[model samples]
Target: MSKVRIYTIAKELGIDNAEMLSILDDLGVSYKSVSSTIEEDTVELIKGIIAEGGSRAAQSGAGASTEAEAAQTSQTQTPQPQTQVQPEQVAQAPATAAPAADSGMTAEELAELAALEAEEAAEQAATAARAELPHRAPVVTIMGHVDHGKTSLLDYIRSSKVAAKEAGGITQHVGAFEAQTSRGKVVFIDTPGHEAFTTIRARGANVADIAIIVIAADDSLMPQTREAIAHAQAAGVPMLVAINKVDLPQADPERVKADLTTINLVPEDYGGDVITVPVSARTGEGVEDLLEYISLTAELEDLRADPKGKFGGVIIESRVDKQAGVLATVMVQEGTLKVGDFLVVGENYGKVKAMTDSAGKRIKDAGPSTPVQILGFSEAPSSGELVASASNEHEARELVAQRQEQRRDEEEARKKPRLSLDDILGPLSEAHTVNLILRADTQGSLEAIQGILAKKETDDVKLNVMLAGIGAPTEGDVLLASTADATILCFSVVPSGAVKKAAENKEIDLKSYRIIYEMIDEVDRLIKGNLEPVYEEQYLGRAEVRMVIRHPKTGNIAGSYVTDGLFKRGAKARVTRGKEVVFEGTVAGLKRFKDDVREVRQGLECGINLDWDEVQEGDVIEASEMVEVEQ
Candidate 1:
């Protein structure tokens, strides 16, 4: 019989070679070499060692006789050992568990147990992948007043020296980008800092891990800046102040820091741990340090994401590009996203045909913390929308439909009017039923309007401002008002052309006033039915009296030069004699020769008939549209 080596037994047992050797050593097996083979006799001896409860004495004098017999039998036809056990290992085999007295376990039971263990192991791996992905990114949104260098700062960061030469400058589209540093990566969202961006930021901040509030060092903190800080706080994300424009001569970092401290963002240099970096987007100074700090913060927070799970991301911004059709900047939050993967962004779903980074370079796949512009969406999604990818196109479509239904439900809930204090109280009370949909040009205006309206509530007619936000009035506002039977009010905000048309069609009564007090007063009067339509008069081209034709009964027909303003048939006419008013009456008829006309332009001669007066030579007729005053 040939000797079977320990290696052979270890290989058969599915255990490591080293562990097999360790087991032999513990059993006090005498071996000539590591490579020594175990023969038939050796197998019998090892089985004896096992039966002896792994005792070192089991291989002594008494076992030597049994071993000799086994060696003799080995020379003939090999006898099957009583138990198939390797040398130097004496323990009850895991496969041979004690069975119940009534029945013994079958081979199928062992195989079933192994299968169950394998399934559990697979489940654990999947669970670990899910557990590793971070829920959100350190979303740093650039914000400040309009034209205050918010976009410029973002451009500087994107075009940093570390960026590849092939990478273009900061993308105009609002999406997130990763600034890679020596330590780690920091994600920065390029958002508009104007009042319109507030809505964008509020949505972005919802999933933010951190916020970077960019303030011009020269200007300190403006009203919008304060509002941004409050928004970041309200989102519950830690903030890092980036005092930009440090290269400018008027830049005052210290003053900016002082101003920020009042808002509770004390700089680290000012004895506070809140990181404040003095940067110059123009000079590209201190950007590295800023990125390093951001990376360090992220490291401390242990940001990580699972690349083996389902993909989820956020839509930074979306727009219809002339060339690309619809483009979206998506910040991938988790899992691997590859080209051709089916994805659903809000209510839209599509197979990803192309993926591009902020620099517009096409890529095959994007992992966690990657901000890529994805192509092939079924439709363009709105900014700040949540996106997720499924296993296949069908799943993606189903998910999109589910999301659309959910959004419809949410919108319906928002449109449902609630009972205000005025609704609960009698109309005789001082409270006025002020129902308005407020829009503003800036966040400050929106906040101010909401604050004032909130405070002006009364027991009888409480201010029932339906919605207040920063941006031009949208069609959604018009539709919401039309459904809720509410009026739309705008403060320093222009209604979009579509919204204007919708408002007119719905008779929703859209009002825009610049003065805050005037707006409040108009709303107050409107609730009380004391408000009326206000109009302004406009001047049209006028005509000079050229030739007169007397009529028997009708007024005298005067031929005149159509000059300066438009001549309306029923407009009030004033005959001015060298800046002195001579006659005041309505223009009964206006015509070019025998043709009766509603208006005539300058340099054209026209015949005009007055209601109760006659025109003289060199008479200057001033035409004006009369407007009624509102009380």
Candidate 2:
């Protein structure tokens, strides 16, 4: 008889290869991989037993054996003299059917079939361990560009002043909250809009079941907005668009809708699947509609969890609460969490002493999709740490200790001696290149720096950007840079204190700057082996325009009084109105009491001519001289 491969039979039964192999193991059946074949009669016996246990169904829709075959086989092997098994029962228990037909089967086949029966009995006893958990609130992540009303919309929905609480109205950390709308309660994860928090935003997108991409009606789609869309897409979650700030006079919902098409997120009104709703985070217009859509989405997803089984969740934020000790905000993804449950998160272990919802209301239990603050962790877990409930305190402790040991080992491995610049450049004398890890505050800045560095390559030396990312330089980046013998360059992103300390410990070269052009210029200087400062600007004098005097031959000249230093005739002048510079040119002409003069002293009145027009009264003219200096 032909033999059937385990994988081919498993595929027919709609069972995973690994699961089938485990089942075969429990039955004492011989097999190597899933491709290992078994006797045809043994395969028929196992399938009949699986069908009898109701663990699986026949691949062909017609029961175990067809009507004609079952009748013929049953009549031949099963005699009415001793005991007769019904045909319906035989059909239901197909594995036993083969045995009744072949009463003289081998002992090995009999033993394996008996083993499967015992295993199915054991499984039936342990089935339905937990009651079915009801559908939970949808966890929605809010993401957008800075000043695009993300926090404002969250504030209005939660009815809290979170925006006001943020320093400079910029969210510095990820915030999780639960809000009760008329439809039902919805959990919201507010991610920082700045590009420096890309990791945090990605984490938010990862944990959320739904994403709300906030777009200001007046502000076009920005780089961060596109990044948010990309993050949401990469996470494979459903998304809703919130067109905020509709109350503003310049708010253009239609224009925003049109711009969204560029990113393939066409509005529902435009025959697309994406739901776009206009809302005013300031005055609460159309806010209820957004919540309704979220509720509908949750219903469509039919989100559920096992309430009585193992509890698992993701850590949203963790900090050492001065009064409460280690407090962590967690979003429950499965099962139910209660006070006094043994929990393990990352390298920490503890019993849940207390739990509270976003409103600070003490709760004894938290279900799936609920964000709660729990106390009693042995150590503060990092953000994005996954949480799991253990069977007992001892088990949790053991897991925590094991994880801590693993982390220590990994850290020690990373501390291995790193390569130095001399180690690389010293070996190559003729041709040399500087490997650099570049980090910037925004995606655009990172791309610009990478482009500039790539274009600046030369025959003698080349500037290679080993890694470029939109975030503050992290310790991992420092380690990579150290291993690669690369210097780290940061533009408009300040490294955290911990990262800075790590870099110092590693003795890595890290250069940070706020201006993009300055960083580019320094890299240019480094590439050309020109370390000396060629020229530096010095403040010459400042003057306030008292009157604007226009001439046919010369451009707009300002009748001004020297405020500080001495105004030189050939010094560069910058005209500033308020905080913005209006014009930058050289001081073409200077006159003191109608006498052509090269310089005018402070506290004196003079007439200054500039190359540009629009010299308004009360505008301040700043003069500076370029003086060549040594390195």
Candidate 3:
């Protein structure tokens, strides 16, 4: 190699090129001074120096031998311009060269030359790997409704047991877990069963490779179930249905299958191949079958990872661990990860100090299909961030700095002033529009709300229900609404305190209502002033207090007239003392005197009895109405 190439190699090896000159000095290699341009003879001499184990004396011997070879070769034949030499002539020249001086190079020199070449090659490999590494994971989030056993199914899958869990078990932070099976491993993110996942869903991350939808066999297909299916379909992932609680006495698998058919999940029982596993998590039944199904599906899809490259993965979740410091559960999609490897995850970079598998076992390294908790990140990485490993700390820091600059530039771009509607569309254009994100407690409620709002669509002021789902309002949903400059309409589902605060800070309108029609009516009114708000209160049937025929002194029966709404026969009934429950008890009887009744409707009176002895005049008796209002 020439002196310039040697300097390049030295710099790459983190050695000062000045030191290379010093080594040449001790080698006694006679050469034009440092300021002179590198000659072909000098290049050969340097190669000889490297071949002789890079020692000063050995380099001098190799340089002397190279000079001797050049002298003898020049006498025998004129030195041709190597750059223009034909391949055949170059090959022949090497074969006919004077061997004595060339062979004088020592084993140490040869080894040193090979070492430098290997180092340069390794650096090139690392640079290529870094360029190829992907920075994010395929975030897979679960969605469904309350009481539909969504959490139960996830808990069963995560814990490998379902009996020891509580009702509505997932009550707090949205957790992420990695499940390994025969086919491969998958990271399951248990997002809050709220509209937040929908927003994440809309972002196109937090969607699954396959959506495992849980629906109760006994309950059949519910509105929430349909909404979950819709969201999954919208996300465009293959879906499998887990018909849960099959151990229940009233569980009807056929009914659920029939119900699912309407929603396009035609079950095998009905002659379609859409896999529906009848599972009873409480009994640990069909869990193995479910795993097998997942494996088979993955095989068919050919899910694969290029494990030969630099490490790249997605951050399933991240949190500050008391002992481990900032920990992140990352699904390694490619390459190997070891302790002390510098990693750049999103805007953060760190030297990995330790790693643990999903089971919390200490591991020295992790590869593809492995889900491991990584320690030593500079900061907590956001969920869904893509992580990559660098060859050194400096490179890692540079990569992070570049990413930060790119993000800053993006933010600045978004802040750049934009032309107004009048500038784009002209002041003569007469058009108005409203965008809304609709969320509800149940699928039925969402459908009802959507149906009501769909009626208000028009040419000028269009009511765009940008996104709708069945769940509580989540921070992601709030963020999405803020980004879209849209209003949120929540029906029945409560908004979390954090989401409420975010909404307030963002100045986004979050309207919540218990009645479906009222929600629709208000949306209609906002979207179009011509559409008067039509409120309809729903009466969900009624129940009565029968046999109040046994009043003693006052000769007054204390039975209830359930003009509307449902009344559980023995549920606590309160006399409304200005919205306060004064009288609450079991209904002693429900009847029209000579007969017993399960429920009483509006404009109907039923005889009932109270356990209390007190009866007074001017006391108004009103039955609670199960009303849900909609436009």
What C-alpha lDDT values do all the predictions have?
A: 0.68, 0.75, 0.64
Candidate 3 on 75-148: residue-level lDDT in tens?
67975543333333333443332332344534444445556777999999987865464432233445555686
RMSD of 1: 30.5
lDDT winner between candidates 1 and 3: 1
> Which candidate leads the pack in lDDT?
2
- Please list the residue runs of candidate 3 whose C-alpha ends up more than 4 Å from where it truly belongs after superposition: 1-143, 146-207, 220-231, 258-274, 419-436, 439-631
User: Cα RMSDs of all predictions?
Assistant: 30.5, 29.8, 33.1
lDDT of 1 by residue, 1-631 (tens): 5667665565555554555556577767655333344566655655565556446565576789989998888867775545422222222234445542233543344445556777999999987875566643455666665556778888787767335645355344436666666654667776644333344433442445667778888898875676556445544566667888898899898998888776556665565657787888788888776675565455445567777777877777777888877777887777888998887866668888888886557789988777888778757887667777788978877887888899898879769967764454444424345557778888788878777777655455566665566777776566556544678888887887888998898789998988998887876666545222345776665667766778777767777887685788988788887788888888888777778888777777787888544568788888888575653
In candidate 2, what residue range of length 10 has the lowest lDDT sum?
Answer: 194-203
- The positional error of residue 278 in candidate 1, measured at the CA in angstroms, is 1.6
Instruction: For candidate 2, write residues 1-631 as lDDT tens digits.
Output: 9988675687688775666777788889965444357888878877877777674454454654687688888889986564444434444554542455444543445555666777987787655332135667788878887789888888787764222333354322325777777657788875544232334333332467788888999997875676566545645678888999899999999999999896567776676667888999999998887887787667656566776667888887788867878888888888899999988877677889988876666789988888888888868877667789998988988898889999898888778957675543354436666777778888788878877787888777777665566878777566555545678899989999998888898788888999888998878777765222257899998999999888788877899999899899999999899999999989999998778999998999999998777899999999999897753
**Best-to-worst ranking by lDDT:** 2, 1, 3
Error of 3 at 515 (Å): 13
Pick the TM-score winner.
3
Q: List residue ranges in candidate 1 displaced over 4 A.
A: 1-137, 167-174, 194-207, 268-273, 321-324, 403-631
Residue-level lDDT for 481 in candidate 3 = 69
